[model samples]
Target: MQDLNPTGTLHIGASDLEYRMIGSAPADAPTLVMLHEGLGSAALWGDFPDRLAAATGCGVFVYSRAGYGASSPVTLPRRLDYMHVEALEVLPALLDAIGFRRGLLLGHSDGASIAAIYAGGVQDHRVQGVVMIAPHFIVEDISVASIAEIKAAYETTDLKSKLQRWHGDVDNAFYGWNSAWLDPKFRDWDIREYLAYIRVPVAILQGADDRYGTIRQIEIAREECYCPVDVTIMAGAGHSPHREAAGATLEAIVEFANAVLQGDEGARGRAA
Candidate 1:
């Protein structure tokens, strides 16, 4: 309920970027980093992170990327590489700054895509597992169609003003995400191949009614990865399982985490 933005800087390239971390301080506890959606930030998570930490007994970390909420805002049109930058570059720095060795990744929408990239790219110390909500590796006709509807609403409805409540620079969050996803070149984007390399456990949850992705997206993801993959379709829900059906989604995450931890003990354990 209280404002949850503990300021800390992460050095990336020539710039020192600051992140607003929020949650109970459990420096050594198994961590669970919250990655927000395309238009999301630390503030946008509301009380979900705190509640989740309490549920799992894992220290939760939530931060706004460079240009959302309290973080520095970007200038213009973004790129497909932006997600890569967040995962391979910024995320490692943040984990180090926070003294977290490895944690669970809880990502939604575009955040899920970035988490997928990070899962694939890590060399030695990586997350124990990942819980991706509505993750997409490739663009689909459904995604494009949904994005177009959002653009329409932003231009014609009160949605832009509503979004401004969560983002300090609403335009940066809006156009940067909208333009990149709608870009013609973005259609070929798919992280499933990269995800195949992920050695950690993964649970992909999606709403069967999700306008942005088809069932094929989840099917493809389930097929590519060698790890034990569990894909759940929240029948009546939409793009946001956490928002539309929080109870069911939280139950799924709890079950998934317990399974991963238990499995790790029996196996030889991952390469160190």
Candidate 2:
């Protein structure tokens, strides 16, 4: 692994995504591609990627999707199927652009949903496994209610300022996600069907006290996915377990990646 500035950018479609690639070269190890939360950016992930790289010996690629961080801004009133677009369109372009041959798709919050959708929808062979942290498989009343509260905080509190530190155009990042979820029609937005087709191993991690979602997300995965799933519900954490329960989250992720990748070379060799 090289020691370099944890900041760089990639041009994907009309968007210039800000990213930081950590750990060894992609050719030397599996690349753990990270997708940020709804209001998250590469910066918001803090030292978790570094910790993950150190723990798992895998290259970590963390990027901010369009409308977040220094990535390109997005048009407002984003469609409810925005996650689908990202999963089916943007993520494929990103993986190809980065020359990803084999890796894990690791996502949090909305990012997790996108990863799940891509893994199940596209069924790409390059993806060896998925690590979904605080994923939402379907719309829930608790989720909407909490998101509504976040909307209020963004207006009445310094939440905007806090988020602006990470997002280039904070409103575009915030409202693009918030508005779509709050939309009446979005209540019907569901990606549970995507879970059934995922062929690779999956690790689902959630905070026990997560205000944004419930254990129903894990139950949905267990019921739907045909692949191996490792589930962990951290006792004292909240929405951001990687941040709130860093030690446990890191340990679980490291173990999961190693186990999944252990026989990858043998499997690929046999297939070839």
lDDT of each: 0.77, 0.88
Error of 1 at 64 (Å): 0.8
* Model 1: residues with Cα > 4 Å off, grouped in runs: 1-26, 262-272
**How many clashes show up in model 1?**
1
**What TM-score fits each model?**
0.89, 0.94
RMSD of each: 5.2, 4.4
Residue-by-residue lDDT tens digits, candidate 2, 163-233: 88998899999999999999999999989999999999999999999999999999999999999999999
Candidate 2, number of clashes: 0
Query: Residues 25-127, candidate 1, lDDT per residue (tens digit)?
Result: 4254566788999989887877777657656656678878877776778868887678988889887777766776556888999899888888888743548
Off by over 4 Å in 2: 1-6, 263-272
With a 3 Å backbone cut-off (N, CA, C), the pairs that clash in candidate 1 are 137-190
